[model samples]
Target: MKKDFLLSSNDQLEKFAGIVNGDHPLKKVTPEEKIKVGVDLGTSSIVLTVLDSKNQIVYGAYEYDHAVQDGIVVNFMESVNILRRLKAKAEKVLGRELTTACGAIPPKTGEKSAKVVANVIEETGMMCTGIEDEPTAAAKFLRLSNGTVVDIGGGTTGISIFQNNKLIHVIDEATGGFHMTLVLGGRYKIKNDEAEKLKRNKEKEQEVYSVIKPVVEKMAAIVQNMGAEINDPVIVVGGATNFTEFTTTFSKVLKRKVYKPLYPQFVTPLGIAMFDE
Candidate 1:
């Protein structure tokens, strides 16, 4: 799927982008009196984020856990427990109650997991006010009126095609971080846990990318199979694409501008906070 392509030659990626790695930038800023939080029970990790009235980051936290796979919760109690911890931390940091929150599900995985996602957030001591598709939630911050938002999760790569800020098509396929971990596990004959850790280590990234290149290719192919012209810049988020070179490979495959934010992993969870109601 590797092919050369030039840059977008447009301001799409930069003009409509959201916060890039708010961990430091959002700190020390005055938070709104009222705050809204979002919980993303991702397949590889559970993330809790807080946004103020103006939709700025007030607090954010996440923990790694394979409680979910391809967006379906496998260990409901474990997920609940993680969210509980995250909520406590956010509340402590923000010095306020976080009683209600919003959450999201991967594309096509919603029918079976949307209620579960909302329930997980609720069980963690907060009222689940809304449950939205992952890509839709991300769109709240991306504000890209036209383009594709590709959510590369732990176990699935979700594609959402939008035209004029409204969703026109969506797809979720089994391919993502988990696949990369699997490849690393097999290559090193190590446990899945060890592979996951190694995959995230800066020292091992170069070696790991060589092994996970195929998995990245699968993600690019997933986007390609969507059967659209897909010429606009593709905005990628999620932990899987956090690997430095995933977009380089994806851009070559699609022969189009593929943009990944500085903190791709936080994009969706933070965006989820925008829908708080």
Candidate 2:
């Protein structure tokens, strides 16, 4: 019950929320300032986040794409293209070239995945200074201490238990947004792209959630199977957790407190950026 991680204050998180517009979520940073960058190549989306020298968020961009699927660079050129576009967008907004960045991959992903991540960052014209497991980067971003950080990414759900600021256990499971898309696609007999649209559309969000519930439950089960003694509140991050209904489903399944920050999708990316300096 005692808090330890360096959390963004409630007010700071409120500023981060802004709102989600899958078409384009871009925030302009104050111009002419040194900044740290974090590039997150997630299974469903690629995010570019920038923080000023003070570690305050400045500019960020998010794009929904399948360049990387399930922690692997399924499409290398697609991954590079997404990162380049996102980087260009952020740089234009901040009016300064982004030169260095940190990135993250799923827990226990092999060396090849790591190289792909680093290479994509380089292809985008930024030096990939550091690469860490997604959960550990989340922990660093959160200054996490004694709790579980569950990153429910697009193709995988990663869980890392941190006790006293040190990671105790980390696991990755292959059940995430893609599975939900499968359910939606099959139920409506639509293509994967259409299902992705339906899944991200706010208008149909509630209606489609019922169909996606099982996928969420499966993710919760994956966490439970980790077998770690998790008594602290679980902090959920990643784009898949962006679903407004997911936290409730996770809480009920885990029978423990669940928390999501203002912009769950940006957490890991922002955390990865924070680790840059």
Candidate 3:
């Protein structure tokens, strides 16, 4: 992908981050305008994204959560409740109800995983428009037709290869941000929750990255082991890629350049919204 193309996507993600941070006000949705919605049920958080008919972001919200583990919903009702609250929050901000939403799961999790995700979306009182794999959605949001998309969520690092805009191969591994938290907790002799907070602290990021670098290397090794003809513009997205050194560490291990977008966490959610039809 061209650098300017990725820059444009990052610009959109930057705007979405501002809206999520309350730095940018939410855009209003007229009554007749069709609003597309997306719900991302991640291991550490559940994100709700609203997009205009033309795929422009309008609103986005998320809540830290543990209702999901890996790509599966471990606590169905909790997932429903979080999504419902997010839907209510978006509706209040946009002054219109979200009628339909698309959701996503880690690749190859099977039809059951998709059903659970869609169920959660419907439980929020919005029609479930569709269920897509996470990397596919991330690729869509990045406008990537060809390249590799590695979606690192809280509980898993999913590697996907796309050719001609179609997903040709995908695999999800059981290692991600939560593993980093566990490593930090073990090293600092703190509980997982405290370690999670410490891992996200910008001031402590250097130390945290040092402790977690091995785990990231393992994730990259998974990609390398896949033995696929890894394509250029290898993009990494999702919440687990938040560390500034993440891509560099990953690239070192994989022996290839890696790309990442601003607010890496919101990529899948924003892309899921584009699937709402």
lDDT of 1 by residue, 230-273 (tens): 63758888888877888899989887778876567777887788
- Per-prediction backbone clash count: 0, 0, 0
| lDDT tens readout by residue for model 3, 155-273 | 88888898898888888888889999999999999999999899889998898899999998898898888765777778999898998999898889888788899999999999999
The candidate with the higher lDDT, 2 or 3, is: 3
lDDT, candidate 3, at 235: 91
Looking at model 2, residue 108 earns an lDDT score of: 89
Residue 263's lDDT within candidate 3 is 91
Q: Which stretches of candidate 3 lie over 4 Å from their true place?
A: none
- Compared with the true structure, all predictions reach lDDT values of 0.79, 0.80, 0.90
Best by TM-score: 3
Q: What is the TM-score of each candidate against the true structure?
A: 0.88, 0.89, 0.97
What RMSD, rounded to one decimal, does every model reach? 4.8, 3.1, 1.1
Among these predictions, the greatest lDDT belongs to 3
As a whole number from 0 to 100, the lDDT of residue 210 in candidate 2 is: 89
